[model samples]
Target: MTALAVTITHEPARTILTLDGELDMVSSARLTDTIDAALYGGRQHLVVDVSNLTFCDSAGIWALLRAERTVSAAGGTLELANVQGILKRVLDLTGAARAFRIITPGQLTSP
Candidate 1:
């Protein structure tokens, strides 16, 4: 299994976290830590780019949901970008897609 990798980029108005590898139970904490750090740093808008993510399990989905809730409760917004293939299918299958603000990569570049 590929190890989980997370790269965080801070933009003027938002923070973007690019996730690669498997987002399973073992790697969920990294995501959670990244989310906490971003929010704690006063970032209100967070964009999680999962275009390079190789795999995602139920734990990953739960982590995403938890991050969304945390951001929302803090009066912030969390968006998932470049979500495709299996990850997208998983979200659809779980009926959890509607709960998030999904966007394309182009949207992130727009002013």
Candidate 2:
């Protein structure tokens, strides 16, 4: 399994997490930790750019849901950008896509 890489980019009103590689059971915790850190830093608008994400399992989906919940609880928002491939299918099939604000690739700007 390819290791998950999360890159953080901070903007004026949001924090972007660019994910690459595989997001599975092994790496979901790390994703959560990164989200927590961003929230702790007073970032209310969170975007997860999954353009480079190679894989994602249920655990990864759970982590994302948890992040969304946490952000909402803090009166914030969590968005998913550049979603495609198998990851997109999984989210759609599982109906998890309904829980997130999915941004199309063309609308993506800097984090």
Compared with the true structure, all predictions reach lDDT values of 0.92, 0.89
Candidate 1: residue 44 Cα off by (Å)? 1.1
**Model 2 weakest 10-residue run by lDDT:** 102-111
Candidate 1, residues 69-96: lDDT per residue as tens digits? Answer: 9999989999999999989998999899
TM-score of each: 0.94, 0.93
Runs of candidate 1 with Cα error greater than 4 angstroms are none
In candidate 2, the residue pairs with backbone N, CA or C atoms under 3 Å apart (3 or more residues apart, or in different chains) clash, namely none
Cα lDDT of model 1 overall? 0.92
Considering every candidate listed, which one attains the maximal TM-score? 1
For candidate 2, write residues 64-100 as lDDT tens digits. Answer: 9999999999899999999998989999999999999
* lDDT score, candidate 2, position 82: 91
